[model samples]
Target: MANDFPFFKKQSNNWVYTLLLLPLWLVLYLNLQIIADFLIDDLLQLQNGNHLTEALRFFIFETPKVLLLLILIIFLVGIIRSYFTPEKTRKILGNKSLFTGNILASLLGIVTPFCSCSAIPLFLGFVEAGIPLGVTFSFLIAAPMINEVALVLLIGLFGWKVAIIYIGTGLLIAIFAGWILGKLKLERYVADWVYKVQIGQSEEEEKLKFSERIGGGYAAVKEIVGKIWIYILIGIAVGAGAHGYVPEDYLGTLLGRGNWYGVPLAILIGIPMYSNAAGIIPIVSVLIEKGVSLGTALAFMMSVIALSLPEVIILKKVLKWPLIAFFIGIVTSGILVVGFLFNVIM
Candidate 1:
């Protein structure tokens, strides 16, 4: 009797699967946008009034909505990711042509939602698996730079155009930087201890069942949401304030559209900060609206994603100084190129 359902039938191809999923994805996207819009607009309306009650009301309503949306999305992505066993990923990467592996790793990185803080463990795992340093760097660069959180937030606030550019440029940077580093033969810079890890066993052997995946997703939501709630609130509040209050002329003068140094300054400023991709995205949107060059703002964002001081510190455990510095230099140049191209084109 269940076979009568045409939609459930597997044909010669899975095109129908995508056709079915696309509508579901669209619905989710729309629902998310509606919630974001309602929260932001209502808060703005209340702020127009000059009363403590209204101010408190605004805070009470908007903050929770933003946080809820973020957590829900993270859990959903985690659930999707749980289906992707790392052993399957390793098989794909095992072919290991430098160019192909770099591209594949960078693309894989975008969908894997680990932040810079979690990157060290993942990096160690990749090294122990005998993945090349450059390919691993591609994963490292792409992970934080093209996070699902940032992509969703961008689509919610700025629409798909900005989001596409952000995602595309990030992958390009990761790919090129990884390839360049591979060509440079920078493997010798790995901490000597990394070479000694036994490779027969991999973390991917711990497979979660469907029930476990759901449970893991819930745990991921709780852990990630709990930790970043304050940061998200503060970051969004600062972005909102800037949105309402910052003078465009002031921003223009500081990060003028055509200024060559603007991109470099953005990267430099972002390097010392310890924000994740999600935290910095709202700020990037605000900066763009306030007349900062697209290149400059994006470069800043990429730097925060790839070169945060804390991330570097964590990498120190696995990499010698020279290797770390080389990684930084290569990725920074990639970001600069991306920044310049977008500024010129868009």
Candidate 2:
């Protein structure tokens, strides 16, 4: 009866079935806090003020909360993404000039269906499609760094103002970083084989029906949720531990605006790590709660999601050492500026 099934989708009953599921989902989501409270306070009867009990309750509450939010958003994003394929994205970026291309590509990166894990292929796709190198870089940076999962978590946890700041600064970073990398004219630095393997554009999405789009959404939930659900649990667990136990003074002294080195140091620590926004945002919230500055926490989150060691290693498959370094350097510089600027402003 699910919308993802093509046969059910072909029938008029598909929408009705989907509508039935909606209220059930709403009930679960709306009463999540109540349910978590029931398990901890009523069922288990754990002592309220105890650190371990509090941590357990935090984890129990946040794990399902984050996952439910992620599933719904990712599913919706997937349906929206069905309209924008790699081929379609390439065509849109193709023939666009430098500045315009970077803007368009960065915006497109949000709706396009690719992640850090698929960076190399997306880069190659853009390259073979004759998109500008800088523009391609823009898409690469924005696609993972300012992704939906991160954006949603930010909005849910930090409110609209912070979410807007994140999006604006993230877009700026992507746009300008790609622009800087483009000005360097580093096309020659790409691996030689990338140039040799020219690919023709395939006409895949001339049209899609509504049910097909719904199926696309279902597939997205399966693929992205399956990959990141464990990370969400792990991240929330780490966050819960911090929320219950980490001393305020340490986080404040280490990442407070008073600490000039906080932003850069946070980035440095984050670059070696690997976690998506879904995994890292909980930690971000904990940092902010524990007295860390938003800018430093954001810098840490950005570095992990956007410039991780693994992503850089993957880029090495296509980019020579110099280009990879420049990519890192330019993006890091942007993140640093954003961190420092925001620390002063907010």
Q: Give the top-scoring candidate (TM-score).
A: 2
Q: Spell out the clash pairs found in candidate 1.
A: none
Q: Which window of ten consecutive residues has the lowest lDDT sum in model 1?
A: 1-10
Clashes of 1: 0
Candidate 2, residues 222-286, lDDT tens digits: the string is 77787777766766777778764546688789899899999999999999998877778877877
| TM-score of candidate 1 against the unseen true structure | 0.75
**Model 1 agreement with the true structure over 1-346: per-residue lDDT tens digits:** 2124354243322344445655775666457645544654564444434444344444444455466567667767777877654456556676688899999998878655565666766777777777887888888888777876776666655668987998988899899999998888988888888778665555446665555555555556667776666656765565545544446687777876778888888888989986776678767867876889877888888888788888888889988999888888988898888888877888
- As a whole number from 0 to 100, the lDDT of residue 160 in candidate 2 is 76
- Give candidate 1 misplaced runs (Cα > 4 Å): 1-72, 85-88, 113-118, 203-207, 231-246
Candidate 2 has its poorest 10 consecutive residues by lDDT at: 1-10
- Badly placed stretches (over 4 Å) of model 2 are 1-13, 34-61, 201-203, 238-246, 249-251
Each prediction's TM-score against the native? 0.75, 0.86
